[model samples]
Target: MTTQRTITVDQARQIVFDAYTTGLPQAAAAKLLTGQATQAWVTSEYAALRRRGIPAMSGQGSLFDPAAEN
Candidate 1:
């Protein structure tokens, strides 16, 4: 049985990112959000966040990233 994606990939990333910045443990955050706080889920979400160049969920951000500059 396949479960429908209740949240989009973007939603998943934002949810995880918000939890990360708040300093909540990943497991707790995942459970609180998706009902399954598995390491694999967290890892995948984090990877997607980085792939999009979100600058790590360190609670600090800017309109532009110097690292993205060529």
Candidate 2:
């Protein structure tokens, strides 16, 4: 059996955010980041970011770019 590495919520959010900004599909991003295409995990992280007032929309603009907000 292999040990699983634990990541903090912030780290998870960053990974998801990066994937989102890079236009990676949910399943593909999740698989690339965690070795499994768990879309639910990606969804959950997006929700969490939303709750924290972070902009996280698929195919939408990034949080750091004000011009993308339009």
Candidate 3:
């Protein structure tokens, strides 16, 4: 029998952030972050990340934040 480890949303966000900083494509990074290959899952995870203030890319602020554009 095998047991799966469940991570917190913050931990998942960190994983995605680190993956992006390493230059991994979003799709690949999402897969690594979520352990799933479905586009819907990837999209949902990205949206959640955005809502939590994780930038979509390196050296940039959250796109959903208006102040980030300043």
Which candidate's lDDT is highest? 2
Inter-residue clash pairs, candidate 2 = none
Candidate 1 at residue 25, lDDT? Answer: 66
Candidate 1 ranges with C-alpha deviation above 4 Å: 1-5, 35-38, 44-70
The positional error of residue 34 in candidate 2, measured at the CA in angstroms, is: 3.1
Scored by TM-score, the top model is 2
lDDT of 1 by residue, 1-70 (tens): 9775567666776778887655556676667666544678887776676688755545544225677557
- Angstrom error of the Cα, residue 30, model 2: value is 1.7
Off by over 4 Å in 2: 33-38, 47-70
lDDT value, residue 59 of candidate 3: 36
Query: lDDT per residue, candidate 2, 6-70, as tens digits?
Result: 77766766778877666666776677668432578888775666688754454354446788767
Q: After TM-score superposition, what is the CA distance of residue 25 in candidate 3 from its true location, in Å?
A: 1.0
Per-prediction CA RMSD (Å): 8.4, 6.4, 8.4
List the candidate numbers ranked by lDDT, top first. 2, 1, 3
Find the 10 residues in a row with the least total lDDT in model 3.
55-64
lDDT of 3 by residue, 1-67 (tens): 9676777767776766666544466788676755434456556766676688755565344545688
